[model samples]
Target: MDLKTASSLHRLRLVSAPEAVSFLLLLVCSVLKRTTEFNAVPVMGAIHGVLFVVYVLFWLDAWNRTRWSIGTAALYFLLSVLPLGGFYAERKLKAEAENAVIASRARAESAVKA
Candidate 1:
């Protein structure tokens, strides 16, 4: 992958974990709101909403840059909705990006040799 594509993927990966964290926190806050006077749902909800938006935006950018298949794009989107899915998404994206970098480097090296 080129620098732009890689950077897009990096951006998505960066937000993935935080987004997942926010989602989990929001879930916890929901339970707390029901059981006690501690009401953090509004704050947590807003935070999670923002992160979810950012994740979607970054996902779109990455999809545009990488032209990922429909199934792959859907998987990422699904992960965002599921609890703790963002962490898995982040890991997968990291691995994919690393592999892309390695392959790109190898191609460059072979071209140089040729």
Candidate 2:
């Protein structure tokens, strides 16, 4: 794949797990707030918010470059909200990037032959 696609994918991959972790932390913070005196909400909330925005921006960039279908876009978007969704999205995105690389290589080989 081209550099732009590769970069966008890399960014998304890097952000995915952290985003998920932050989301899970946020959930835990919410529970802790209700059950105990713990108040990790502010810190975790800010972190999750930043990570979520980064995830969305990278996802949008990849979607625009990849020209993903509505279903695919929606799947990724929905997946971002779940506790483990980011991990799933990262896996799926990795597969997609691999496929893209293979396709790009095949096309290049065929063009060289022609």
lDDT of 2 at 2: 90
Give the runs in model 2 whose Cα sits over 4 Å from its true position: none
What is the alpha-carbon lDDT of model 1 when measured against the actual structure?
Answer: 0.98
How do the residues 24-55 of candidate 1 rate in per-residue lDDT, one tens digit apiece?
99999999999999999999999999999999
Q: What's the lDDT for all of these models? A: 0.98, 0.91
TM-score of each: 0.99, 0.93
* Best candidate according to TM-score: 1
User: Which residue pairs collide, candidate 2?
Assistant: none
Each candidate structure's count of clashing pairs: 0, 0
Q: Whole-model lDDT for model 2 versus the true structure?
A: 0.91
Could you give candidate 2's per-residue lDDT for residues 22-98 as a string of tens digits? 99999999999999999999999999999999999998998897788999899999999989999998998888888
